[model samples]
Target: MAKDYSLMEDSNRSSNRSIHDISDPSRRIVLRGGLGMAIGRLLAPVAAGSAGCASGARGDGPLLGFSSVPVSTADKVVVPEGYIAQVIAAWGEPVGLYGETPAFKFDGSNSAAEQEAQMGMHHDGMHFYAQDGSRSGLLVMNHEYADDGLLHADGMKTWTAEKVRKSQAAHGVSVIEVEQQGDDGWQVVRPSPWARRITACTPMSFGGPAAGHALLRTAADPAGRRPLGTLSNCGSGITPWGTYLTCEENFSSYFNGPEKPSPHERRWGLRKGGAGCRWHEFDERFDATRHPNEPNRFGWIVEIDPFDPGSTPVKRTALGRATHEGATVAVTRDGRAVVYMGEDARFEYIYKFVSREKIKPRGLRENAQLLDHGTLYVARFDADGRGRWIALGHGQGPLTAENGFADQGEVLVKTRQASDLLGATKMDRPEWIAVGPDGWVYCTLTNNSNRGTQGEGVDAANPRRNNTTGHILRWKEEGDVDGTRFRWTHFVLAGDPANERVEAQGNIKGDAFGCPDGLWADGRGVLWVQTDMSPSAMGKGDLTRLGNNAMLAADPHTGEIRRFLVGPVGCEVTGATGTPDGRTLFVNIQHPGERPSGRSDPEQPGRYSNWPDARAGGRPRSATVVIRKADGGPIGT
Candidate 1:
């Protein structure tokens, strides 16, 4: 018989699992052009709902540990009464003495050089280093993107040269030393020696299939060996050898291009005619002429050695570049590392990279280089629990010149195109994916809001969209991550049971959730479900804007999805990892309030997301939340 996981699940994971922690108070502030509209845009909806939740508790429902509630008001975590959480690091902690973060100069005036020393905003995905904090390993996190005009001193100005340059630098990753402060909490070690920032200017090398290809060569990199910038660093992965791998998401939108591009550019959806991001106006490097092969260089999984500050990060091209949302890896039973990845755009495809050489956990050197050479494959799943991994091999199979696909090299260079050639099912905006130690791989089909309408399809994988309340897909690798086939199923459809949309997806039969974005299975195999992109209240079909975003733990065996903790208004829950002991769970909350949607108050002056800051009222900060069991035991029901 299968192991009865429910017996091993944390008891009452639901008690402290739910709490009412919503609070609303308008703070007078300055506005950046885009952020000034937040009040008017949200006041009628969000603030109104928050007001209702504050008017006193309606029935919290059963203590099945399933209710999702707002953050605690007592300056501590508010879970179902059985769980607890604490603040680990906030924005602007003394991370590597960037001189006290220079007050998040939101204006686009800061130079690229200065921005590198400061922590990037909107920290999304992060990983806790198994190595001791003192031993060089640090928590490496993706800053995603500097939201609105935050991260600048006088507020973003002119979106000009210096400002754009500053924006670029503020978009990578921050590595900081953190250690357990107690049985269940973690804190950053000030002035950490291992703390470092990987910005757009950081020196990096290329790896994998397209490392030195002609497509990757730019005027600045004639040899096609080095790429200077990294942008839109989204979710990430950590190899068994202990290096951090961050992927670039939405890179296609960064550059502006022609309606229909050349074959190569079209493979990745770039316009053949021009540059994107308007960075060309201020910096020639952004121009294709100056860097003809530049665009092809991004969209690959870039690896950073957190253990070596001086090491040059490597972009593993073999993984195939696209709008890489995130990378998650599982060590197959045979010791090879299988990296699970996604392309985070509507109708994008999911991918996996399996190394030819088996992984040795202690072989840091080999493991570090393992991602350099590999065969990348995209995924196609069926609702009935079975699927196939059609190989988009380089010169292999039907991917040949005769059939319109020229070669393996071309396949690597034009990944999406190759996946299309092989009939890889177009998926909902696939995001972060995680593999459980028990050998089950779980993925989040973030949302396919525009799939069908945009000439995309209702594929077996991405079944629905505006799919306001997304679902979680899970599969078990057949023998290994490299297997050509597997079993799959929609594990959970997110929504609120009390709401009508919940009934629409049939999740009301179990649990109602919205936008299942982040998926992480603990060492003991408890899956954590996080919500994002919940639609506007009401019109949301069966889904409603119940709360900002939240984190929940699910017992795969029992079908029980209990709410963990909800975030403040206008934020997304992302980037999760646990201390080795599993008692402390670290979570990232990003872009609270999106800075009021437009305008700037001249007096206060910071446009957008005053959260995690004092001026925005409350903490007004974007910080990582740490949760633990009250008894200091492993959590996740």
Candidate 2:
């Protein structure tokens, strides 16, 4: 999740078609009747529907029974000889909600009201709800931005307003309440009432159809339906009526713009001395030239009920916003809901929404406005493996009002300019979106060194042209999740299939990884995968043989891929979850002493990783970790 590239907003000039033009050799022998029988007819109906998937394995032989764990330029956390791990919840700890649990003072002096009761900073995408079931409940997560040199003390030299309210109380979302403690394992149920946090100032509201539009009016929420917080809170989702969705990535690097910045704030990268989190020098409402609609109220998809700790977080915005990178709900077999998103950067796209209403067996108060009424769609992919979703509604076609889209809340606050005027299919940076319990959906695309550069070439599902090792894109929808047509492939392509540079040689069949950011697919479908690889590109070049950043599991019915965990030095094996009896898994790890100039030198704060408190000079927090199976069996077995 470190591919900001100064918010590379796609300027898309239409002309779609490129999934390598289906490798044209007559559409590659009629749409790949080759590449291993086109990935065995795209995973043989997900391994012949694995006996109706989802039940935590065991009647299996090889769904990845834990063995693979190699690549490790260590610093700690490796797991896989009957796994163990530990460290439950980290960053500035103590998310005891109002009972105040503070206590995480490892030198960065912790206070902006004790980091708003702690725990926020770099841990991305999460979700593990349960209740009294799987040992306990509610983990929630996604505090996706804030490194500010190990979050201040003398770090940004002395920035004021209390280091901009402790870096806006370390950017949004946390929740807490965990349990499972028989063998002294998962803990954190601190002042539990579903121990909330939700920061970046936490006030939130805004629901669908661009909430109160007028480009989300703001001179301090002019009825633009609130929106005071939730910044780059990356990848997350849970909802089958339970709640918690998160998303909202690279929130235009937290405002500041306006030295001639308007083309919708330069298509959302804002600019004019921002992106460094000075929080527009002590929050003048982040000064987008004096709060110009506060960065259009943050790239959305909020939701959040976590057992209603006084619920409010909303921002659904009909699921349109870009830079989202998460949001994977699914339901529709006639219940409606759908979701599925992704739009990390470099030539963005890939979206979904569907929910016009239907999910009701009495949950979250009759599905409280079920995602504020949906129908977003944006994909396009066709070169013949098929795809097409389009829609972005407002007068349909060119999203009219003469192409400026005057309704549907300005086509959802210009969702990437209405998917670049509905031409879509521009990816290679689309972060997370899971699904697969045989319904197949997946997506990661996490690498794009500006694909083949100059105007970003190389396509056909982003066919590596400088892609720096990254792949994984599945699909299926031809009928269910409110189908709009689908059928795609390439489930794995991440690097080091012995690279000598054949686009960084990837086709991973065993253990070789690079940049395939956090993804999920649990409930027995395996497919964990996590990886981010960017403490200034770890060891350098083709990601220096993919070491540190790790977490893998994949088995979408025998496509086998393992490497169950590795992560420490300058970390980022991002948010994963478990424990609906999958016997505990958690994961997270984020900025462990992140240097290579991505901030942190608070006077040698554990150089490049002191992970989970390696003591001696402290300061490298961004925790979570948990993992189990020291015979308590279940995770990836």
Candidate 3:
């Protein structure tokens, strides 16, 4: 089927580690009449237009910018002077009833039942809300995804019905309340009420185009209004109303799609690849012929009320389902919620959804419905760095075509088909999204096949070929979310190391690294740039050698990218979150140096990334790393 994946890439999926390789592991804009004050918050002499950064300067800690470093190697975390990193949480760390992460080993034979209680693997896309700005609260994060036996006792293969249950439990999200003791500290809050898991086994509600649609029904969810689990909960955002919004990235892989679907079944772009059916080895739910509606239940944005853990999670159908990467929330000129999303895939598309209602504020009832009603749009960014949101509403744009969409519900259920119907600009694999507090939305156009001089032309928005190296784009919405228009600009272009030569002009001597992903904006507007270490990029001497994927703080106003932290070998700096006080920075080091497993005998390798435990001799557990200033000062510097 024809497709448009631009909205949010359900990228870096599939037996991850293989895809999560930071070295090549994969994976925005502002509007406003304001005079760039977000970028103006700093004294950036080199990077001038930088209005979006956390002001990385402090009294006398690590110097600001990417000028200094500790070492070189794709297996270590690098940071400016004065900063130290500590692993906060890692895979197998217990969080539920059984305690102590359930008995575990890095084998695929693990029963899904055991998968619960333990922390999920390959932690990515995360956010931090300071429960007690001074010390502790909760750290909400996404496991993004899991690898084969990589995260299980056996792996994806040895998954028994019991194992599937645990895997389901392990696939969603983890929340932990924590407290800082002193200079170098942090400990779990031993199970606070807000602490709960929203795994693939948890109950979730549907509220969009596909909701209650007969096509979405399954033996488990015969009513079609609910889904048993949510796999691929990737990058995410916190709503203005204080709820946690989790994205469903690469959710398509969890179901089974036949080589060809019958007339009544859904046919995604996967048919071109053929030979599917991995989940079939285990359950009938994976059988498309028997469960045509299964896959549709996924690929939509999910929202969970963190404060009230018992609330049923809602999937905003208005957003239009596809391989949703992550979403950022913005307030329209009229005050409605505008969510920007990207579908991470080569030649895919970008999208936006403006809620029918406005997000009034924290603790407001209307804010909850803000995402229930709205219009969805696909993006088309031109070479001049300008773009527009193509309306996909009923009777507008592609939805007007005479297909099967007789109403708004149909338009939404077949959102992806509609986007394809409209000629949306296919972009580089897009990932992790962040909207600045100042009204600008930014997305990481990870990379694409430029077709160099061949096929895929290098457009202005995506200016590179096979764009191994990526760039960040920021756009300002027209008037507001429902305006039907928007302006765009390339906020930053990721490049190789300083001494590297550009495919064109000057020796792009700067720290413009490759494949941008995992983005989040702080209270002060500092843009944190994290790089996915590509094998070639890591081995490229100094040009783009990030040791591993490094997290850099950039001044969007001045366009200066500074390396803040580096991950270990075979790992990516997938998720980074911080306290409002800006004292502690929590980062997830996922699947570092996974011992290069051989596909032949999948379970032979006995090594794993045992992070945080700091106890693991070398085995690195996909874990969360905590960074703080040596002297107990604010962390941004």
Candidate 4:
């Protein structure tokens, strides 16, 4: 077969009875004692600032534009002294070409039809694609998930069909044209054809080896290629070919309807109760058993062309599906494309797909098909600070009929099993990934609470027994960006230097933060790290002192990190993107007023964050903020 997508599925699937619960006894691999010690010794110097990160590749110009911003728990965004931030778009705001929708009512009163043309909630992972040389561009952003209490006029206690419809309308990607106005001001360019919405109800198709697999077929789409909408779009990336790659994370929570669980269904979290959304109550398709394959239709990387509003988003199956955090691309010396992705679950593996064909920059149609075929490889870090990319290709070692893979399509469908069979290194809830200007790869290993309590044993890559405060991991390819072998090291072992988490670990520097999640490498190679702390981890001890989730800048050369901006209380600092000129920066502040303990308190419900409108008593809405320096300097230079 002339394959465009990578192949090789996994066989280590959890039993149906225990699928939702991932403590699969049959597939546990433990590396104990000396092996773990050796790995730890190899990575010990990273916190001491001794190895791995490129020392001489610092970009020219000022390394930092302004002094570090002080941490705050205020209800507003605190930027560097001279910089200013303005709310550009919020949930329920009309974002398309003007006149298409009415002005948004600050209260939760927008109809489902109205919200379809409005900006979605929980704004995240945005990119600005320039049109007239940065003067104007299309801002494509992801709407991760929604909160029912604040999203509707009446809370979840009285959620009507209209409320459910409006909520679904708010769960996808938004593309709006924006232009710089009079010096530093930026606003949405209404009435532009490029301004549109792609929500959970948007039409999309799966392409690559698993496009028409049996697992993807649903009653609504017998062909198995067509799927409706993308959900829980967390981190995302703008592809070199000018398309937006919106990731589908935690898509498993949307489905309901099944008393007895199948192993496959359990693995994806398809159970009797919903993830509090209870959309299954209103829509039959949301019920997994009624439409068993609907959940499979999601969880793929969906690519969208922002410039073309009429384009049908494509779910690229070449990249194996899991809890996909996002896909960041790095081009090789020979023009081939390499996409680095994180599976976003504890003990899950990190993955990459290298396209078979070199990219031809001249043709959009041809370049769009580049992601269709590739060789998928999972990472396996060794105790010697070295790592290898194990191929997930069919007919390649271990991936065969005997191992549960019938073909390449099956390999892609069951990617987690494929990695297990290949013995890929299980990471600590890997989240976002970004390739730096120096051609090195950095990934955010968000906290894994179950590290010591269950599952995998401690290793150098994941040194902590219970990794409450996660760390930043960076790797350099042995030869080129496409090299199979690589050397890796820790960039940030997040925690306050004064705290025991830091003292016991002895791997982080003086300046630190916890739960490192959103990560991006700016044009100047300065690494921007965002924090997403759990409620239970906050409000006390060092976490309380760490304050609200914030964005920090790291000098790759010196490995010195400094806090740049702090968001309002209870908000997750996420999705950093700037204009090509690096003058204007865009960030998403998601779910303010979120409980500190990650649990909803009925007595004090919806009292966490009052952001974007703290002065007035209004519902907290996740919005995108545009930040610019007064002197028009490059952001985080």
For lDDT, the strongest prediction is 2
Question: Candidate 2 at residue 37, lDDT?
Answer: 11
At residue 495, give the lDDT of candidate 2. Answer: 84
What's the lDDT of the predicted structure labeled candidate 4?
Answer: 0.72
Model 3: weakest 10-residue lDDT segment is: 16-25
lDDT of 1 by residue, 1-637 (tens): 0001111111111111000011000111111111000111112221111111101111233223334455321222356566776775665554665344444433334455666666676778888775662222367899876643344444444456776676677678888887765554567776766878887768899877677777778877888889987878878877655677898875654555455556555555565323224566677665544455677777778988887777888988878877887787665545666677887665567888878877654546746667766678877764344677776686677688886655555677678767766656666667877664334566787554443444443343333424545566666667555788876555556555565432235352344567778777655445677766532332245544354567777666556666777776556778887665555678888765443333223334433335555353222346788777676555552
TM-score of model number 4: 0.88
Candidate 2, pairs of clashing residues:
18-460, 19-460, 19-461, 20-460
What is the lDDT of every predicted structure here? 0.60, 0.75, 0.60, 0.72
**lDDT digits (tens) for residues 552-637 of candidate 2:** 88776656688888888878888887766677888888887688655777888788778777889787888888888888888878
TM-score of each: 0.80, 0.33, 0.83, 0.88
Q: What is the C-alpha RMSD of each candidate to the true structure, in Å?
A: 13.6, 22.5, 7.1, 8.2
Question: Candidate 1: where are CA atoms >4 Å away?
Answer: 1-78, 82-84, 97-114, 132-137, 153-157, 182-185, 263-267, 271-277, 382-384, 402-406, 452-466, 498-511, 534-542, 595-609, 616-620, 629-631
lDDT, model 4, position 116: 91
Please give the distance, in angstroms, between residue 303's alpha carbon in candidate 1 and its true position after superposition. 1.2
**TM-score winner among the candidates?**
4
Output the better candidate (2/3) by TM-score. 3
As a whole number from 0 to 100, the lDDT of residue 98 in candidate 4 is: 54
Clashes of each: 55, 4, 92, 21
